[model samples]
Target: MIDVLPPWPLLGAFLLASLLLAVTPGPAVVYLLTRTLAQGRRAGLASVVGVALGNLGNAVGAAIGLAALFAVSSLAFTVVKYAGAAYLVYLGVQALRSAQAVPQQQAQTPPATMKTVFRDGFLVALLNPKTALFFAAFLPQFTSAAHSPLLQSATLGAVFVAVAATTDVFYVLMASLVAGRVRRMGRARLWGRYATAGAFIGLGAYTALSGSRGKA
Candidate 1:
């Protein structure tokens, strides 16, 4: 992939941008926070694992040329985009409903089993086509056909996933800690739960409405 390598300055800039994008407040971060706050550290870690798997899957898809297929096909692109949009809206409504219910409920519940947690996290990531698009677009600026496109994309994707995973794990652990403390008090717990729900809804809306997109 060295043949198509961008100039060092451009490559460094792309990598930096990818790191920033990974940390920005978005569906993944919001989900991590909400899960951590609601379920605790173990469940939150499970979710993070699943999300990491999803990111790996996206990277693999990009490496293998599946992402290019979507990029070239407008119909396919629309289908994937709308599917992601629909899922986001569904998640938003669920969060809003849960927020409405949490105030009336008095006790916090135990988290799900690791299996169920993993399944939920996996499904959420698997269904999100936007992640693949991100890989497709983000990697190319650092690569070209002159290089081994697959390797370059894979390398960039792997770096991004590594940085992002580390950042998300930190979020998960911190959120879990704060949430555990907050849950001891009733009103604080209620507000925390509400805030988590609102974050989800806001992320969903942003994902659905935002026009800025990486090439698929």
Candidate 2:
């Protein structure tokens, strides 16, 4: 409850969300696993760090854009922000309550030095449309109006990058250990959906009860 990143509930929720996303063996995790299986563990680790930096950049951009809106129109931001968060939470809940297919695919990148691997991974992830969209779409739901918007944005970005890197490292380990079953673990996403939905609900409830809206 020290509230280093956001308020305790949001911080906890973000951490849970980050962990769920990271460990779910989604696109990013699958990408890392393929790299490890094809090239080597070192390359996979490099890619992990590189992708993390790229995601950080995306998160920062999204955070800045959203925070600037808050500065310009607190009233509009209030309406849009809550509405968007609610919609996303609804989507997450629906996903949690539904069953979905988890398809597996990986892009091939030739073996290379750690630096090249890192650079390629960085560029690839930085340019990924989903990264930008996801950060802008989801990160603001946890922001605290009590803090400076810029500070909150940066902290969330940093935390997201850190959590992603750590989780990617685990995928790299598993890939090295057993490449054949890496994609087979897609069932993990089912649990991740639950965790993500729970986090969303927790965040929405926290925002409602914390009185941040009244202060804002």
Candidate 3:
């Protein structure tokens, strides 16, 4: 609600910070680019939607105190973090297997269904406990003490997600252009599959190993 928002100057600062954070190359950006280059624009766009939705969920979760739960309970954080990492590894393995199963002549066949792609993206983003923690930590900095903290947090989270989604869509469009060129080369197509798989697997490892006390 407008009443919960911080002053215009504070809101402007928050928007500026959100834009910078959204554009920074991070796990989400890598995921988007890999999906676009490997699967196509449709999958990439689906992934963007899925991720955006997942992020929105985290924002809501933060507003409702889920982040505090994770912050206090190491077990909860570890369980969720490992689960997410495992899922990423599973996706990577699936990509490799799918690539092998498809014959060279069938390369034109779609790598995965849009539903599957969307689900993968959603789960990947949702499972990252750090994302929830990030929202919990980040949104409070711009909140006004005189207003409802919960509403302000949720509103700012929504705004941040919107900015991130816009940047993600741009990344997809750029990656799609490169993918068009890669499609013309059979070897490049095969390599693209491997690269996608590697990216996912590597991200999984990174997530699993990263410190628990930090922003996503």
Candidate 4:
């Protein structure tokens, strides 16, 4: 196993890049933060694991040839991308409606069970064209021609997911910490709801409207 792995220099560089990218907030971060702010740490953490698993799944697909399939078909990419965008929009609308429907006192009602959070997070990450394209493009660069590309890609993807999961836990903690203060203020709570909805909608629109991702 060790012999098949990438050299230390390549692995080190990949890990560093993954760390930096993971810390910088993206759509996944927004989703986790919203869950934390609206619900609590447990919900947020469940989402983290779900998204991480989804990402790992994508990396595995890329290792196996999903990247090649997409590379060969632009229409396929467009279809998947729009489907993901639509899902995000649906979530945003759902969030807005939930905010209005749930009474302030009923905040005790936990709508996001761990399984629900995990499922949503998994679908969100899995359906995201950006995430799929990202792994397709990103993983191949660090692989060595001397080794089996599939093995190298799998190892790199696993490492990337692990590092990303760590960073996600950090964001969950930070979001949860501020959640208490936000909960105390009615106005803050309302606006936070808006912010989460807006973030999801904005990202969805962007995904729906964007042109084809340049290869890699």
What's the lDDT for all of these models? 0.72, 0.62, 0.89, 0.81
**Candidate 4 lDDT tens digits, 120-211:** 88878877656666787888888878889888888788889999999999999988998888877876776667777887788788778876
Which candidate, 1 or 2, would have the higher lDDT against the true structure?
Answer: 1
Q: Which ten residues in a row have the lowest lDDT in candidate 1?
A: 103-112
Each model's total of backbone clashes: 0, 0, 0, 0
**Local accuracy of candidate 1 as per-residue lDDT tens digits, 1-216:** 445457789778976887788778667877777778876888889989888887888888877886777777767766766665566566557655655665446446444578876765665675566788778877877776767888878877877787888888988978887877766777766566567657656665665566644533
lDDT of 1 at 142: 76
Residue-level lDDT of model 2, residues 1-216, one tens digit each, is 233367677688899998887777554565566567645688789889888997888778667784344445657545644654454355346545542433323222133578876875675466443455567656778876776766676778788889989988988987777643442456543444455456545544443343332232
Among the numbered candidates, top TM-score falls to: 3
Q: What is the TM-score of candidate 2?
A: 0.59
What value does the lDDT take at residue 10 in candidate 2?
Answer: 68
- Candidate 1: the clashing residue pairs are none
Checking candidate 3 for backbone clashes, the offending pairs are none
lDDT of 1 at 216: 30
When superposed on Cα atoms, how far off is each prediction in RMSD? 3.6, 12.3, 1.2, 1.9
* lDDT value for model 3: 0.89
Q: What stretches of model 1 exceed 4 Å from their correct place?
A: 1-15, 89-106, 144-147, 190-194, 212-216
